[model samples]
Target: MDPSIVREIHQIVPENRVFLDLQERYSYSYDASFGEYLPDIVIQPQSALEISKLVKLANQHRIPVYPRGSATSLSGGSLPVHGGMVLDMSQLKQKCIIDRENLLAIVSPGVTTAEIHRKAEEAGLFYPPDPSSSHISTIGGNLLENSSGPKGLKYGTTKEYVIGLEVVTPTGEIVRTGGKTVKNVTGYDLTRLIVGSEGTLAIVTEAILRLIPKPPARKTMYATFAEFVTSGVAITNILSQGILPAAMEMLDQQCIRAVENFKPIGLPTDAEAMVIIEVDGHPLAVDEEIERCAQVCKEAGATSVHIARDEQERDKIWQARKNVSPALAQVGPTKISEDATVPRNQIPAMMNRLREIREKYQLNLFVFGHAGDGNLHPTIITDKQNKEEMKRVEDAVSEIFEAAISLGGTLSGEHGIGIMKSPYMEMELGEEGLRLMKLIKDAWDPNHILNPGKIFPQPGQTKVVLTDE
Candidate 1:
């Protein structure tokens, strides 16, 4: 960066908030995903005006601006792949107000999702998008990725809750999109557009999120299947019977054994697969629905079904599901997590294909995700340093995407298509569809000054390059 540009940036943000040291720049290089690209500078601007001014400067110089939250993005959404300016949005975390009357929560981008959950619940309300990394992930990242966790089976993704946004455009103008009202049909839905845009179009400074009354009562149960594919059968049967669970999570044999090994939670290691289901509503309705769900699982060939006797037992059941990632992490040094979704009916086929892929690649692969919505997370654990193995891992990932598209599914369910999944966008959307998306990106950021080298693949880049030879 030129000294003149550095001086201009310093003028926008105080010297203390501007970090130019190599150590500070290195800290912002990598995210939770693969690859690392150090940014030229990191700036923690306090206000939207400051960000607007900085973005304008970036556009004038054609410098890439990467807006980052807690860097918990699993898809490399926050990685500064172009090595320009890194905007640490975590510093703008002062505002969080719950508007109970309107059922809305006005919040700053830096606030963690878990804080919103705690505040909403305290106000006798609920904000439902609960990603696994909610405790650490900021609201900005969740909004950008439209991340939703296990509960996404019943509730929708982060895009559904976001009603409005205070955004700094790519070329540097502060603008407001949508409003506090849910039924806003005034113009284009820019709020929805920005929610999952992955920060290419604009930078979100604040957001207005919709909330609902918290569920009063809930029931939890887990069903084990002798065959892994039988778990999918149980899921389809439960949903077909009109029993909508708050969350329907599934884990394969590998995930089961891994969790049991990591923590002796007494999980049924002998079972080939397990499905955890939870339903919430009226007390009587909850009881009836839970029993019905168990019966459906049994009819679908579930080896055993157990309903939690109390909340403690319920948490224990969920703990087994929550322990999956860490448990699998113990299997290898590198973990590649992919969320490929299929239609509910195609889940069995998808699971079969995943099984075949796992065997073909001869890698440590474990599967789990929100079963009700057909969003399956097939994670591969391997040593990236093993060049030969990484080549196989790359091939396996490509096959996973192809299988999903063939089954009328998508390359990503909740995780955004950051650079990690950019190459496959054309495979899923076709040439024209991808071009139309690029048109939107180009129109929004003509200078390409915001979050460059993301979502769109470079020329001749057909597949992810995970290994360097």
Candidate 2:
């Protein structure tokens, strides 16, 4: 970057906030996802006005501005692929006001989702978009990715709760979309458009999130199935019985063994699969729903059904589920996590496809996710340094996406199409559909200076490339 540009940026933000050192820029280079592209500079703007001015400067210089939060994206959403200015939005942590009267949370981009969850619960309310990485991931990133965890099966995703936003557009205009009221049906739903735009459409400085009354009581149960497909059958059975669990998470034998090996929780390693179900509401309703779920699991061929005796046991059960990602991370040097969602009934077939892909590529593949919502994360654990194995991993990932699309599924569920899944966007949305999306992107960011090299695939790019070679 030119010294003049740095001076201009420094004028907009504090000199201390401007990070030009390679050490600081390197920290912002890569996210949780694969690949790394160091940005030319990293700017921590604390206010919307500062960000607006910085964005204007970036647009004037044709520099790509990548707005990043806690960098917990699994799809490389925050990676500075274009190597320009990286806006560290985590510094914008001023506001996190709980509007109890309106059942809303007015928060800045830097606020962690866990903080919101904590405050909401304290206020006798609930904010249900609980991503696995909520403890660290910022609300800005969650809204951009529209992340949803197990509770999404019943409560819905981050976008559903985001009723309003204070955004800095790509053109450097600070604007407000929607409002505190949830019933607003204004002309264009720019809030929804920017919510899942992955920071391409605009940068969110603040947000108004809707909240619901906290459930009075909750019940949890875990069922182990002798056969993997039977576990999927049990899920279908539970849902068919009209029991809408707050969360329905499933783990394959690989994930089961991984969890036990990582930390012994007395989970049956020999079981082909395990399903954890959770329900909340009145105490009587919770008990009845859990019992019906247990009976359904037993009828669906569950080898064992263990209902949590109390809160401690319930947390222990949920802890086992939460340990999945870390446990799988220990399996190999690099973990290629992909959320290829399918229809609820097609889960068994999708699992079969993942198994075949794993065997065919000879890779360490494991499966787990919010099964109630049909979002299954088929992850491949491999060493990226191994060129030969990475080749196979690439092929396997492509096949996984193909399998999902074939089953009337999508390329992603919670994880957005940042760069890893960009090549397959057309495969799922078709050429015309993808073109319309591109039109929207072009209209929003004419200069393409905001979060470039993301979501949209480049010409001649047919598949994801993991290695520089």
- Estimate the Cα RMSD of every predicted model relative to the unseen true structure: 0.8, 0.7
**Alpha-carbon RMSD, candidate 1:** 0.8
lDDT (Cα, 0-100) at 64 in candidate 2: 97
User: In terms of TM-score, how similar is model 1 to the real structure?
Assistant: 0.99
Number of residue pairs clashing in candidate 1, backbone atoms closer than 3 angstroms, sequence gap of 3 or more or interchain? 0
Question: Per-residue lDDT tens digits of candidate 2, residues 245-343?
Answer: 999999999999999999999999999899999999999999999999999999888999999999999999998899999999898889989999999
Clashes of each: 0, 0
Per-residue lDDT tens digits for candidate 1, residues 1-469, read: 7899999998899899998899999999998887789999999988999999999999899999999999988889989988899999988856889999999999999999999999999999999999999999999999999999988988889998999999999989999999899999988999999999999999999999999999999999999999987888888888888888999999998999999899988778899899999999889999999999999989989988999999999999999999998998899999999999999889889989999999999989899998889999999999988999999999999999999999999999988888899998999999999999999999999999889889998899999888876
Estimate the overall C-alpha local distance difference test score of candidate 2: 0.93
